[model samples]
Target: MLFPLFFMLMFPVECLTDLIEPITGGVCGIMTPEQYSEDLYMEDEILSSVSLSIKESGLNDVSIAPGYGRLLTMLATVSKAGSILEIGALGGYSGVCLARGMKEGGRLISLELKEDNAALARRNLELAGFGRGTEYMVGPALDSLKQLESRGERFDFFLIDADKENYPVYLEYAIRLAKPGAIIAGDNTLLRGRTLNPDKNGPSVLAMRKFNDMIATDERLISTMLPAYDGLALAVVK
Candidate 1:
């Protein structure tokens, strides 16, 4: 029981890291993991600015990995997403990244459970120049999703990074909330690579396996899972 809980919280089940084996581990070509991260962050002004805010605000453990932040920003920018929904708003780290890639006049709705975290995200988002285009909701994410559904809200892109146990349910809701071309990207799909080995079965692992299988098998979604930090599941609504 303890192991499962630890596994779930050990990494952001919301968004996985970029797949670099380790700083001293084998190569993914010629670059080390640390080097890859450095290259990606070299001229990344948006992340640099947001990271400074995160440090100053003491949102230390809340943001996504820098490499993953760049990936999220690229997904949003390349998709030209007009509306974005993020299931977790950890100090607004991922929110800032997602918002930076939004089309002009785009809006981002970030849902966080803790009011204090929500407040912190609001501040960080403001510092990142996304205060006007983002809304922070404080509540159980499922309740917030219901409210959004009631409001007839739809999104072009989704970033799921909340509880590991609820990932599949969130995937269901995300599919319902997405437009045809919408993209549903989930973090920590690898569950620390436990999803690949059945012997390592645990609640979180089982749940993630179910979620990944759903994405892969669902006829409505065309999906692929990338081997990033842990894993990233990208599914497009067909």
Candidate 2:
């Protein structure tokens, strides 16, 4: 039968694992693709709800990847962030993750360029049980940052995932708005690897390159670039 042949062909899976183990230095020992997938999408009920909300709101195109969400959550948790500011609020997926990772009574403020996206994010945040400690502001992120600055608001963490052309400006504003020892993160820093090609690099890539260079050279911060999930740039203020 076809099933018997298929089982026989797949039966010696451990042999493949053993072969790869030495090559990978025992990293993924005997784990199948399915197991790897489970590891990648390590979500509980709230994260699942946030993901479902993003899908239902038709915001999959702008939603953060699961791995990126986990990274944000881990950073928030590690920092014990009391005040988080997010530059983009697409469907509230990342906001929910950050809020969930915050210390008890911590607050998150998200800025969205579109009113509809802001509403969608507010709804999604409420659905994800972040209705209490989150706020969605509809405006240009730079303008919102100015307002927050005028109001003397300082954040413990900042997440920048908005228009790429303004990444450097965002970093400047984030630096101004950050508290001492705050963590700032920027998404999509690699721009699909176009930053390397001078002729091919567009405004976004060039701006991101400038942003990366600034962070790397800044004496006031410690920073690193993560190669995964389209490149994440993280900096800690001194």
Candidate 3:
């Protein structure tokens, strides 16, 4: 859980801290994580501005951190995605990142639980000049995901940042809705190191662990986990 703004940044499978105060961790060649964030994390006035809005609006401050945001953008761009699906839209911080990577006519569909949060994210995305290409489906995320599945809609990229408890379910749906060569990325999968804690057998932790396990073991996808802020799991759907 961490931020360019971290909760439900894909849909985190829980409150994976997208908007928590930036912490210094992770390792680079020479610079410290704090130094890397201060120096390497690209600066985007729009994202910075949106982050401020979410913080002031009393919304979940656990927005995805700028580091993860940049990574999402790069991944989306590298994948040359035409359609991106985001499981959770919190303040549109990650949405903007994902959309920035889309090919010229790419589309982005975001699922959010609360009306207010969705409204806010919609507004922010519009502000980011993604109005025409962005769509929002509000209500329980599972319901919207099911609707998408029923409609036979598929995506080139999938971001799972919602409820940790439902992450496995979400991953199943993602696999079901994915196109060949699609990319599936998840956040807070490390559950702030809880997954590695043998002492923590809590339900959410267990679920997150399962999420990681599925990604790691599923033969349909090739995946890896990055031990940075919280943790990041990235997979390529085969």
lDDT of 1 by residue, 128-230 (tens): 7889999988999999999999999999999998888899999999999998899888988887778899798888888899999999999999999888677
Pairs with backbone N, CA or C atoms under 3 Å apart (clashes), candidate 2: none
For residues 1-238, what per-residue lDDT tens digits would candidate 2 score against the true structure? 7996676576476656555445632333555443465586777787677667767767655666667788889989989999999999887888888887898998999999999888978887888778899988888988898899999999999999999899999999999989999999988887777876678777888899999999888998999998765788999999
Q: Write the per-residue lDDT of candidate 3 for residues 69-107, one digit (tens) a residue.
A: 889999999999999999999888989999999988889
Question: Following a full C-alpha superposition, what root-mean-square deviation does model 2 have from the true structure?
Answer: 7.0
Q: Against the unseen true structure, what C-alpha lDDT does each candidate score? A: 0.84, 0.84, 0.86
Comparing 1 and 3 by TM-score, which wins? Answer: 3
Residue 208's lDDT within candidate 1 is: 93
The parts of candidate 3 lying over 4 Å away from their true place are: 1-31
Q: Which candidate number would show the highest TM-score if scored against the true structure?
A: 3
